[model samples]
Target: MSKSNPVVIAVGGNSLISEKEKVTVEDQYEAIRGTVRHVADVIEAGRQVCVTHGNGPQVGFILRRSEIARKVAGMHPVPLASCVADTQGAIGWQIQQALSNELRRRGLGATHRGMAVSVVTQVLVDVDDPGFVDPDKFVGEVYQEADLPVLREEYPHWVLKPDRGRGWRRVVPSPKPLEIVELPVIRSLLEQGFNVVAVGGGGVPVVRGDDGELRGVAAVIDKDLATGLLATTLGADLLVVSTSVPKVSLNYGTPDQTDLADVTAQEMRTYLAQGHFPPGSMGPKIAAAIDFLAKGGKEVIITCPDNLKNALESGGGTRITP
Candidate 1:
């Protein structure tokens, strides 16, 4: 694990939400402050960083707000893709500001020629993706089982599913990101020694028209998957996916559960095929790790945000290699 090579860090949406009672904007900002401190450590360690983050919780909050205004004040509801774009700016701004401030505090900012920027990124997705037909990405507030009927009556198009042991929540289509339209800009930022935060909520999902024009679509792209693609596209040496866990596990949450410290892409793919990782949990991360490694990425590290420094030190976290 060389600290000098470029690294793509995919921060999880849950990292922004500390607790159920602390979902306020201020709380999120504070949480981002904590995360970016670790990021600054990575930067100080000599790694050029490009960041991507999940927007599930933030997008859900915006959608809930829009839904409330639509029902109470007769306002138009925001489109799903628009909500994603909104969070990219909102969350990206928070991260950009926090990272910059942290870098400045460590004497790495303007005085030392360090900087950070956030891009309102767009990702290309296949318009005909089957995910649109089956909305699998869970979002928004969870509801009690008793509210299912009322929810169906209010939002007929919403697909409600039980989010593990949590509660029933709205699920949306999470189309695969095919290409990042702003990859050149991101690379340019890295070349300039500026840390970049891009591809929030897997980037505002978009599709190319017959005339090659791009338009936003009503779909969410998985951030890990998009980060993997971004890493490969940028030729990043490492893709560090910061999730809610410190490691990737086999048979997660069962009696025979085992945490993986290191594995090859082929071995992880075999576990993925064996149903060890579920789609809603570690599946996409594993898939992303395999994709990145297969696409010439030197390594992929799946760990929690707090463990990012240790993961880079190879002290912990699941490391996947080609």
Candidate 2:
């Protein structure tokens, strides 16, 4: 790869699945095709990229399906970590296929050109992380209040929480990602000119046991935090986080909302402290940008997938710098 060609992109869940749809496999492929076109444009411009993506909706769908399957035929329900792994495979396959097709359409060769690979990454975290004591990250399907007791009895570890104005949902421990276990493998793939996607759903949060082996834990890791760690580990020049919104904004959804084009890490932290970003939504993205910039990343861009190129060149979107 060229010296000038290093970027890590975290594509938001919106880019893969729309809120209006049920996220069927066909729909995911179509969505990924659009996303890959954007990525292919960047690659055609001579940038090496590593992509990460949010799996919230996709994993939730998988869990819901598994639950329904269990109810219908007495099949064993898959674990949350397993669902994350499933999404990694399903989404990665879509991305890889779409990227390959886009490259081929651009006249890039079918073999050994514009390659995309996905690694099932395990992110190390403390088994006793405070997040485990207080589950805050919402996951899986929304349920009625009457349905909570049955689920709670079935899954004792899960924390059932009611969303404001919405139905109840399960909240799982979302611990901070400590390290990307597959970083070396990812680096090797990138070195070989492959567009690697890893750390899906914060990398199947795991911990090293006393036996010195890695074990999957019943916890989620924030995708933005994992993406930040991935970017820093790969020494990426720029970290781009794609989201549903065109840019980060203060007083989001309010009449007084203001979009941000550029901001310093310190400013972002201040906004975070001021509650400009909600913890359930934009807060982690801001924190991730701050973390990346603090670790010496040249820039972090937060924008929707369509605005990525514009964000890079025109100083659009929310830019976080050290």
Best by lDDT: 1
Residue 79 shift from truth in candidate 1, angstroms: 0.8
In candidate 1, stretches whose alpha carbon ends up further than 4 angstroms from where it belongs are: 1-5, 111-113, 138-171
Residue-level lDDT of model 2, residues 1-322, one tens digit each, is 5433368889876568854654688887887887878788777777777888888888888888888897799888888888888888878777877887788788764545477778888889998899999888787777898998888788887788887769998888988899999887888877777877788777888899999998887777899999999998778879988888888999989999999987889998999999999887899989999988888798988888888888777877788888
Candidate 1, residue 289: CA error in Å?
0.3
* Residue lDDT tens for model 1, 1-322: 2222468999989888988999999999999999998888898887778889988888878988987897699888788888988999999999999999999988888632357899999999998899988888777677899988977987788888889999898887888889999988887777767888998878989999999999987778888899889988988888998988889888788898899998899999899999998887788888998988888899889888889999988658999889
In order, the Cα lDDT scores of the candidates are 0.86, 0.83
Model 1 vs truth, CA RMSD:
3.5
Candidate No. with top TM-score = 2
Model 2: lDDT of residue 105:
85
lDDT of 1 at 305: 87
